[model samples]
Target: MCSGGFAKCLGVSLMPLAVVCVLCNILLFFPGGTTVDSEHITQQVWYFGGILGSGVLMIFPALVFLGLKNNDCCGCCGNESCGRRFAMLSSILFAGVGVMGAGYSVVVSAVAINHGPQCLTKNGTVMKWTYPFSEGDYLRDHSSWSVCLEPAGVVSWHLSLFSVLLVMGIIQMALCAVQVVNGLLGAICGDCCGCCGEVSM
Candidate 1:
């Protein structure tokens, strides 16, 4: 195993990471989780829960692979090809999400800087970031919630994770990338035997 190899990744890693993600989502709701809609059953069970869940599931295998390949546990399973590929691609996709999510936050922050956060009136309910409008009328109605979008001195947990995730995401991408290359190489190598369906047209 070379340095920084997938050998170090194990399914156990998934366990802890999943726990953290789920915990974060739980905290997010009480502490306030972003409310939106998305697709995928990702680890986080809100907004984009499905997508996040799928992403976590996909990445989980990489860790499992570590257990199988590196730790000599669960050797030579069935249908590894498709599962491995799915996991690889999904991991890359999920991890890459951090980049995109942070991009939105950055843009929101910039807009906030330009124009103060706007107050919004939905169902005649007032919602400001810091000061809760709970059941009150939105004093500052129908404008840019840009300030609310970005809290002052606010270090977003997502943003902070984004930084860390970028690195981990890169590693995940690289790992899956290599796995993809390996898969391709394996397929090509297998078919190159030149006996099954090679017809020179």
Candidate 2:
């Protein structure tokens, strides 16, 4: 298959993944489907991992990849093949950007999962927003989840959403990595079967 077609397929697959990351991040702001003060939310949610990292950053690369197929240039010093190669080469930079973004999201999601969620918990007869779990301790002990007095099941909510983000981030990273290789191959070989223009009979 032509490199452009392969890139287009990758781009199509990335779009939905990016959307899912954004949606998951947004939902993280509202634990257990209930709204709370912004300050009470987990700190990691503020990092905008899924929003900026996975969602926005991934969108750029996806769009670039999608357009690569139609980026057939005809008037570049009368070197259409050279122009196509350059276009593919340029996509490598975008793929690198995507890798970085996804990596950021993965890091943030992992940290958030480890730190657990911030929720109202009783401390010596006083209630305040605090992280009840220490470094993923709550993941093993479900009974400890009672520490979070408000937001109702916030621990589970946080874990689920952040886990989704982590998985999606990893997937995004893998896809971008693949694009890096694809871009390199496209640059080295140019588009296959006269992908830039119709073959002369």
lDDT value for model 1:
0.35
Error of 2 at 143 (Å): 1.5
Measured by TM-score, how close is model 1 to the native structure? 0.35
Instruction: For residues 85-163, write the lDDT of model 1, one tens digit per residue.
Output: 3433343443344334323333332332233212222333654234322222322443323234432212233333333
Q: Model 2, 31-146: lDDT tens per residue?
A: 98899998998999999999999999999999999998885433233365457778789999999999999999999999999999999999898988888888788889999999
CA lDDT of every candidate:
0.35, 0.89
The lDDT leader among the candidates is: 2
| Per-prediction TM-score | 0.35, 0.91
Please list the residue runs of candidate 1 whose C-alpha ends up more than 4 Å from where it truly belongs after superposition: 1-27, 30-45, 49-55, 67-127, 130-155, 165-167, 186-201
